[model samples]
Target: MKLDARSAARILRDPGALRVILLHGDDTGLVRERARTAALAVAPDLDDPFRVAVLDRDAPERLEEEVFALSLTGGRRVVWVRDATDAMTAPLKHCLGQASDTLVIIEAPGLTARSRLRTLVEGHAEAAAIACYPEEGRALEASIRQMLAAEEIRIDPDALSWFAGLLGPDRAATRGEVEKLALYAGRGGQLSLDDVRACIGDAAGVSLEDAAFAATAGDRAAADTAIERALAEGTSPIAIARSLLSHLHRLRRARLAMDSGQSRTDAMRALRPPVFFKRTEAFGQALSLWTADRLMDAAEQTQSLELDCKQTGAPDLTLCRRHIARLAGTAMMLRRDR
Candidate 1:
């Protein structure tokens, strides 16, 4: 069965009826978060080796075996597959068709409508597919409220709107920001716009908004300086790279809208978490420099660099710096050509 975002939380709370739950989407963070939530629903003790088994896409054949195996401790069992792909479709289909008590959750990247894996899960009577996209509009506000309420924190309506506007596309990042605000406000205290700015503004490399703006706007010196400051202040290279990718994605959207005959001003105004007023001109200049196709290419390169930084043998900070420097150089060249 196909699950919409509104019904997803309710279904996740009691996923016992479903044998296989497939969480696939472009938002990797949301996919992983939902997968963990579902796993914990079945196997509360995630750390227990006997109850929870984590596998990768390579071991699709082992899925059925793991599902059929009786739990050593005699309670509910969970078998989670990470980075699932089409290659595992056959085994998953066979496994989902059989009767089993174990909860099988597959975390996959975004799948096409015609994808066999997506079709199998969505079409099967015993399975369900939950799409994990970035939340926006009313949905985004509701999520913010829910997360903040969990911490017993309250915010002024205006403050809540401002804070929500600053949130990134990644759910994990959004959670982190809310948690930071909650901690700052303390229990039962109300947050104001001032508090939001104080806690979030220039809080190290965590908020790479400034650096990202600089990089994309062809301010090579400012971008280089900001990146160096962030790294010096202990910001992870992967985090910075992700921020850059998010910014580029926004630019791509604006460019696409313009290609479709919308005015640049209108396109920028329509952006979710709307562009900050201070950086409006820089953002416009970025649109002029990076076309939709070039933005896509830059995004791919940044993602690859982030993956490399995560490798054990890699110098993450150094690799991140190199990536930013290269982008800065490209930005400069693009500007000269224009």
Candidate 2:
């Protein structure tokens, strides 16, 4: 059956008689983490080759055999199938309804609801499909708060709201940021708005946002400064590109709202995280400068640049700089036309 978040988490701690556990979603980090949790519940040492079997997509005949095969160590075993897909349906199907102490864990990151593997697992009584999407809004805030609370730390409401926006979509990345905050606060401490800014403002996420805003507002020097700092701080150029893409996507939303007769301020207000107060003026400028079509083109350009950055021998930093220059130049041209 398909498991809710609570049920899925509970199962990882105590998976009784479950033949196959499918963790699928866009949040690959969460999926991998949960998979390891569930597997560790069965086999205490997942690194032990005798008790755990890790398989890739196009693997040998070990999958079905590993599912039912008794471990040499004489304990419950774990079979981890990474990057699973609809193609894995038949292999996993054969394991269902059979009596075995082995647990089959599948990590499928991009499976849709109509996916055959998902349908099959949810249909079975002895199997489960768990979705691991990224947390957002109140959910994200609560998660950060709960995590810190466990560490005996408290974050002020405003700081929590701002901190939530700094987190990325990846669950592991979000947890890393939370851990940083926890360490910053120490035990039995509180995080205020100023503290949050001091801790995370210099982070790559914020720096990337700074670069993105500078580029979109036609501030070439500022964009270059932020971009160089981000790269020098060990952030990959692709991450910088994605940050730009995210900014453009946000602009696309606001532009659509403006197209529907909402004022730019209204469109900004409609944003979930709201424009960070510091970026409010530049945000407004970008909104005013770019038409909806121009924002679409810039978003596409950034997306392609991200893919290009992945190519071997590519000058990723140089390419990223050029892309930022283009964005700034375009914004300038739009401003002149206005």
Candidate 3:
């Protein structure tokens, strides 16, 4: 069965009804979070030796054997497979056919309608396919409210909207920021626009945003400083690269608008989550150097950098810094050519 966002919560409550659950989507953080929820529901103590079995890239060839094996403690067990791909379809399909008390949860990336694994799971009567795409519009707002409500905190409408804009597509990061805000507000305390600004403004997100803006504007020194600050704060290189990709995408859109005869000022003003007033000038500078085509190229490079960061044995932080520096240099050369 296919599960929508609204119905996903049901799985956490009673996952046993479904023998196999496939959580797959572009929003990996959400996939992992939901997977964690399902696992915790089955095995309250995650560290329990017998109840939980986590399989990663190094999982054995006969994964079904692991799934069908009896639990050491004689209770329900959660057999979780992380980073599942089409390569594991055979074992997963085999496991789905046989009946067992074990709740098999597989977390995977976004799959197409033609994906063999997705087709297999979705076709099964005892299996469920849950898509964990990033929530937006009312869904995003609802999530923010639900999270805050859990901490017994209330947020001003304007503040909620502003906070929502600051969040990326990652559910884990969003939850972390909300949790930080909740800790700051305490239980039953109300959050205001000022409070949200003060708390999130100093976060690594702001620095990362600064780094993106600086790199795109060709301000190498400023970009380097912002990137260093963000890295020192424990931000992952992949996260930084993702932020740059988003910024480049926005710049590409704005540049395209300009190509369509809109003034740069007008195009920037029309951007969603409207460019912050303080960064308006920097954004304009970036537009001047990064044309639509160049922005697209930069986006591709950023994506490549993100992938490299995820690879084993990759020097993620250094590669991220080098990429940002290269972008900054390109921006400078473009500016000089103009």
- Which candidate leads the pack in TM-score? 2
Ranking by TM-score: 2, 3, 1
| Candidate 1 clash pair list | none
103 Cα displacement, candidate 3 (Å): 0.6
On residues 64-114, what C-alpha lDDT tens digit does candidate 1 reach at each position? 899888899978899999998898799887877778888899999757778
The C-alpha RMSD in Å for every predicted model, in order, reads 8.0, 6.0, 5.9
Q: lDDT (0-100) at residue 90 of candidate 2?
A: 79
Residue 249 local lDDT, model 3: 88
Task: Give the alpha-carbon lDDT of every model.
Answer: 0.82, 0.85, 0.85
lDDT of 2 by residue, 1-338 (tens): 98998798789999998888999987887898899889988888878998999999776356889888778878888999999878888777776756777888999997988999999999998888899987777887887888899989998886887677556567787788888888899999999887888888778778788889998998888988988887787666766776788789888899899999998889999985578778899999998888889899999989899889878799988999899888988888888888
* Winner of 1 and 2 under TM-score: 2
TM-score of 2: 0.68
Clashes of 1: 0
- Candidate 3, residues 1-338, lDDT tens digits: the string is 78876678887667867888898887888999899999888889888878888888457364777687888777788888888878778888777777787888889875767898898888888888999987765788799998899888999876886577556667888888999999999999899877887888888878888999999999999999999998998777867877788789889999999999999999998876567778999999999888899999999999999899878799998998999899999999999999
| Model 3: lDDT to the true structure | 0.85
RMSD of 2: 6.0
lDDT of 3 at 60: 39
TM-score of 3: 0.65
Off by over 4 Å in 3: 60-62, 110-112, 207-338
